[model samples]
Each structure stands twice: as structure tokens, then as C-alpha cells.
Target: MPMPGKYSLQPALITVADQIGFLKQFFSNCFRKGFEWTEFFRQAYNVGYRSTGIIALTGFILGFVLTLQSEPTMKQFGATSMISGMVSISVMREIGPVIVALICAGKISSSIGAELGSMNVTEQIDAMEVSGANPMQYLVVTRILACTIMIPLLTIFADVIALLGGFTATNLGGAMNPWLYFYKATTALEFADVIPSFIKTILFGFTIGFVGCYKGFHSNRGTESVGIAANSAVVTASVWIIIIDAIVVQFTNMFVYA
Candidate 1:
């Protein structure tokens, strides 16, 4: 006889173990024979190019609003001249990567999960296996790799857009030269600030793709499970993004900042 509470964690433990195994398989297949370069490029286009509009819009709004909100506080301290630097550092170091990753976790993760889940439900994956096609290599590996590559690029794009937005917002308050604003923003950032954030975005992208693929690939055999998989993928990926961001920030503080 065992307490119900004792067994309550069993499901979670099993899920963790299963996910670890899946991750191991992914790494194993990632570098194996017959890499799908064409599929990888296609997925990269879908992941990166297709996402530009939304990322641009979000980044602009984020920078504009952040500048507007911080103006009053900076004025209070008489540090108004440092607004561009503040916005740039905040966006480049923290806000830009994290926010963009969360947005992608919602958009890209759900999209991948639903697409794969639908395939799983319709037995398309099974059919591929029957036809002796390497579906995992063609599908999962390409998608995950695309995400890993594109996400950092997207984050960099967002950071530029955000700085532009900040410049716009700053000009709205008073006249400022574009070159001067950009110069301040660029000078405020160092290699330490940019590289860590870039690395974080890469991890964020991999986590988003990995969670989405794992959930969809393991979804139960039903149409309803497709929805469940997509929803779960978004939630899980978002949670992991936050967790990874926190861990990275701690390590960065310890090693980089220190």
C-alpha cells in the first residue's frame, strides 16, 4: 500500500524521463547521416522570414512604450540625456531577447505543435515510416535546427527595430539628431551585453522548438489531442524560457558582470 500523494508525482517523473530520452534521441539524430539541408532552409525561411512583421511591430511598440514610461522617471532624476543608452542597454541585454522569445514561444511553438500533432493524428508519420522515409530526420531535425538558427537572428532584428522605436519616442519629446541618438545607443552596449543575450536567444529558440516537437510527436491518437499538444507546447515552452532566462541571468551576473 502506498499513499496517493506518493504516487501523485509519478506521472511528472515519468514525463521528465520521457522528455530526457526524447532529447537524447534528438541529439543522436541531429548529426547522423542524410541531413536534410533543403528542408532546413525551408524551415528557416518559414521561421525567420515569416516572423519579421510581427517581431518588428512588437519590438517597436516595446521600445516606444518603454521610452515613454521611463521619460518621467529619468526627468525626475535629471538623467534624461541617458534615455537612449538606457533603452538600448535594457533592450539589448534583457527585454528584447526575452520578449521576442516569449512571443515566438506562443506563435512558433503552437504552430509547430499543431502541425506535428495533426500529422501524428492522421497517421502521416506512420505512412512515412511505412514508405521507408526518415520522417524524424526530415521533419523534426530540420524544424529544430531552423529555430535554433533563426531565433537569434530574429532577436537581433528586433533589437534594431526597438532602438529605432526608442529614437522615435525620444524625438517626440524633443528634437534630437538620429545619428546622435543611434551613436549613444550603440556606444552604451558592449560585447559582454550583446553576446550573452545572443546566446540566450539561441537557447530560447531551441527550447521552443524542442518542446513543441516533443509534445506533438508524443500526442495521443485523437483530434482533441492535437489542440492539447499545441496548448501544452506553448505553456511548457514559455515556462522553460522564463526559467532559462533566470538561470542565464544568474550565471551572467556571477561570471560576466562580476
Candidate 2:
């Protein structure tokens, strides 16, 4: 008889087979019925409206912290007065979007995962289907759409708050005419930095939302499964964000250098 080997592993092959089947079904539904918008609104409210406060707080303080932390570094370069412009560029191109995304991944992703997991555990999704409802449109589409719409909006708000935070932190360190600080910041901002940062956020938002929904929607366990689902959602979303960010950074550098 042939020796047993890793290629003969049952569980891994079974999982791959299951995922392929799930993908086929998921695509079939997407084409057959398209999607529903009203449910999307409901999920949008939960994902976007509910998480505003935390995003704002994080955005503001992140800006402030970055500015304060960089003072010594700027001073070392003998361009201490250039702090305002540096803060503005940093916040616009990188800090603002990344920080906001991380916050959303923690708050909104976990909430979505737990909510969907609970619905799964209680058989609500099953009942909806039995009642002639499309659970895919009702559950996944709306949630994904809301996240895609709201995350960029949140990123914009975060950019503004972070700039304000940087503004405040700059003044705290030394005396500078307020207008001068803003003037320098205004001049430093280029279309190159601002536009790509904003555009990349849409991808980040979709990735975070998609992974969270996919994980929770497929989760199976008991009532205790809810915890696992939520935890996994946060971890997966965060990991994806970091991975995507690194890739985006490399891509951006290539374009910049070219």
C-alpha cells in the first residue's frame, strides 16, 4: 500500500472543497437577484452613524500625538518651524486614513461580526429565507455598501480633525503666528498626496467590511460562537489593513519614483 502523505489530508481538502462550493453559490445569488438597497441603508446606519464618536476622538488625538512627537525630530533637522507643513503632509497622505481605518476595524468590524453571528446562532437568517427573503441582499450587500460609503467619509472627517490636532500641538510647543502655521500647511499640501490617499481608503473600507461579513456569515458554533466570530473579524480586518497598506505604500513609491 502507498504511504500516507500530506496530500492525502482529508480536512484541508474538505475545506477547500467547501469554499469552492460556497463561492459558486455566492456568485449565483449575486447575478440572479442583484441586490437590495433598503437593507443596505439599515446596515449603513449601524456601521457609519454608530461609530462616529470613536473615529473622531482617535483622529484628533492621532494628529496631535504625531505633531508633538515629531517636534524633536524637526528641531534636530533645524527646520523646527517647518513642523506645520510636515504635520499636514503626514496627516493627509498617511496618518489620517490609516488611523481611521484601524479604529473602524476595531469598532465596526467587531460589532458587525457579533451581530451577524448572533443572528446565525438564533436562526434569524434561516427564518428570513423561509419567509421568502434574500438573506444575501439583506445581510451582506447592504453591510458591504454601507462600509464602502461611510469609511471614506470617516476618513475625510479624520483628516480634518488630525489637522486641527496638529495645529494645536504645534502651538503648544512654541510660539508661532496661527495664520503662519496654517499658511505653511496649506502650501505643503499637493494633489499628489491628497488624492491617492483618499482613493485608497475605498479599497481599505471594502476589504474590512467584506472580510468581517464573510467571516461572521459563515460562522458555525453555539451561542458561544458569537465571541469567536467577533474576535476573528477584528483580527482579520486589522491584518488585511496592514497587509494592504504595505502593498499600497510600495505601489505609491513606484509611481512616485517613476
TM-score of predicted structure 2: 0.86
lDDT of 2 by residue, 50-101 (tens): 8788877888898789888998988899988888788888888887888888
Residue pairs with clashing backbones, model 2: 40-142
**Where does model 1 exceed 4 Å of error?**
1-7
State which candidate has the highest TM-score: 1
Clashes of each: 0, 1
Using all chains and alpha carbons, the TM-scores for the candidates as numbered come to 0.96, 0.86
lDDT tens string, model 1, 1-258?
A: 865585598889889999999888888889899999999999999999999999999999988999999999999999998999999999999999999999999999999999999999999999998999988888899999999999999999999999999999999979999999999999999999999999999999999999989989999999999999999999999999999999999999999999
Weakest lDDT window of 10 consecutive positions for candidate 2? 22-31
Residue 61 lDDT in model 1? 93
